[model samples]
Target: MNYCVVGTNNMTASQGFYNALFAQAGLQTVLPSERMTYWIGDDFAFATAEPFDKKPATHGNGTMVGFSVGSKEEVKKLHGLALRLGGRCEGAPHQRGPKFSAYVRDLDDNKLCFSD
Candidate 1:
């Protein structure tokens, strides 16, 4: 995919949360605007922004963004980092069939998961 965009109602809080987050993963911000910020890794690029339609941004039900770190250890570290950075834990890291997974909700209530 080209990129994924998540909407934020509180830009400062959301941006701060994402800044701390992507930094831990070593993702670089490729674009920044008053209303948006984008980060790029080798595989997938994601961003957060204020909605263009002038409406309060709300989380989409049943939608989630997933990240893959290379190992279960990295998943744990990232999940911990997320919680420390104002994210709420949705699921603790664990074996899921054959993969290890963890879930969290961002400051904007966007669901995110890390897998290995």
Candidate 2:
């Protein structure tokens, strides 16, 4: 997919969370507006936005965004960093099938996975 977006009720908190997370992950911010913020990497893009319908943004029950961060070490690093940045752990880093992965829920409770 070209990109994926998660909904956030609090834009300021979401932006702060993602800005620090993406900065360490090497994703660059582009095309930011008051309601939406995007981070782009070489092959993919991720974004967070306030709902366009003017209702409160809520996390989808089964939806998640995953990032392939290249190595188990990086996955672990990001998992730890995310916790330090206020994300909650869904799962700790470990090998799952052929990939090493970890899971976290952002400040808005949006799920994310980091895999290697």
Candidate 3:
């Protein structure tokens, strides 16, 4: 897929979370707005939006979004940056066979993984 999106209850704060989080892989915002913003990477787009019905956004129990980067060091650095930017650590950087990965929850509780 070329794009992915997750819901947010607090658009402002969630935007901040994604802004700092995606920068680790050098993604840049292609579209920015109060209700939604889309960040474009070399091969994909990622985004966040407030609920259209005005209900509080909630995380799916087992859903996750993953970003694959160029190297293990980038995975580690992004994971650390996520934590420093208010994301919660779900898993620290570690290698499992061919993949080195780290997991984190965005400011709005959306699960995400950084992998290499």
Candidate 4:
């Protein structure tokens, strides 16, 4: 079945933090609302919500949402943008043999990663 994943977090900053990261990777923002936003790519789309209480669900720990890009430069660009948008660098971008990878925390402390 076709499916999409949406994550809800207590966020003071809305989904702007995620929007910036997707934008840097040249992905389009497909649907944007006051409390939620979506990033569209060929393989999948990601949605995020800004919850009123500003707390993330307890189930998200050890879970990571990964985005795949075309090049290492795109990974670096997205990682840098995430930092500028209130995301903390969990891991800096680097080569993992054939792939470049990095991890970062969104405004709500949810871990998001990228690889190329």
Query: Which digits, one per residue and each the tens of the lDDT, describe model 3 over residues 1-116?
Result: 87888999887787777787665556778656678888886788888988778888889889999988778999999999889989899999999778999999998899999889
TM-score of each model, in listed order: 0.92, 0.95, 0.90, 0.74
Local accuracy of candidate 4 as per-residue lDDT tens digits, 13-48:
645666656654556675556666666666667777
After superposition, candidate 2 runs with Cα above 4 Å error = none
> Which segments of model 1 are wrong by more than 4 Å?
none
Residues 1-116, model 1: lDDT tens digits:
78899999988888788888777677888656788888888877899989998899999999999987889998998899999998999999999998999999999999999999
lDDT of each: 0.89, 0.91, 0.85, 0.71
What clash pairs does model 1 have?
none
Tell me the tens digit of each residue's lDDT in model 2 across 18-82.
Answer: 88887766788875678998998888889999999989988889999999989999999999989
What number of clashing residue pairs does each candidate have, in the order they appear?
A: 0, 0, 0, 2
Model 3 TM-score (2 dp): 0.90
Better of 2 and 3 by lDDT: 2
Q: Tell me how candidate 4 scores on lDDT.
A: 0.71
* Candidate with best lDDT: 2
Ranking by TM-score: 2, 1, 3, 4
Q: Which ten residues in a row have the lowest lDDT in candidate 4?
A: 1-10
